[model samples]
Target: MSAKSTVDAKIAQGKRTVVFSKSYCPYCRRAKQLLKDANEDFDVYELDEFDEGADWQNALAEKTGQRTVPSIWIGGQFIGGCSDLEAHQRSGKLKQLLA
Candidate 1:
């Protein structure tokens, strides 16, 4: 399922919050932890578990222009990677987004 449609379908399922991440990435871990600490409802897709995770990431890069782990979406908006999420966390905008 390396097709762009597959990724599009996953993103379009209307899951209020989603995290495209890798289990081994510290940034990804931090992003998840931050969301967890905030008690934010979200689903995480561990890209590393997929056989074509790298290719999927490439497709994602083409889609969102982010080639990094912890690609986050809230209310169907791409909020960017770990650092961006953390910035939002610190700014208290993360809570607002979750709400």
Candidate 2:
């Protein structure tokens, strides 16, 4: 199956805290760290480590209208990339997604 379709299937099932990222990306690391610090459970798609990475990223951009990592989705809402998520954390809006 295509990486794009794989991602689509997962999303259709539920959000369940999914993040599209690159293992070597600092921003991705920062985002994951914040989630970890918050004790948040999430699944990760380390694009850089996947053979289908390019396909996945292309699909992610097409679907989310954004081409960046860490692309975060919590509770069925696409919370955007790393900085965007940080803004949510700063504004205390992150908990709402967790709950």
Candidate 3:
């Protein structure tokens, strides 16, 4: 399947969180850590580690209009990067979304 298709399928899988990240990105680590601290189970696709990494990132950019790593989605909805996740957590929206 195409990278775009894979992205779509993963998002549509609902009730799960997905993060398209890069192993060396501090933002990615921060985002992931937040989720982990919350006891959230999520899937991580470390873009820098895979052959189709660029393709996946391109697909994600097209889908979400955001080209940064730690591109996150929860329950099929696009959630912004690390700072956004932090905001959500501060407002208690992250917990609501996870629930």
TM-score of every model?
0.91, 0.91, 0.95
Candidate 2: pairs in clash: none
By TM-score, the best candidate is 3
Q: Report the C-alpha displacement of residue 8, candidate 1, in angstroms.
A: 1.5
**lDDT, candidate 2, 1-99, per-residue tens:** 877788887666744898889999999999999999889988888999978887899899998899888888886678899998899899999987787
Off by over 4 Å in 1: none
Candidate 3 stretches greater than 4 Å from native: none
Query: What TM-score would you give candidate 2 relative to the actual structure?
Result: 0.91
| Superposition TM-score, candidate 3 onto the true structure | 0.95
Which 10 consecutive positions of candidate 2 have the poorest summed lDDT? 7-16
Please rank every candidate by TM-score, starting with the best. 3, 2, 1
lDDT of 3 by residue, 48-79 (tens): 99899999999999988999989999988899
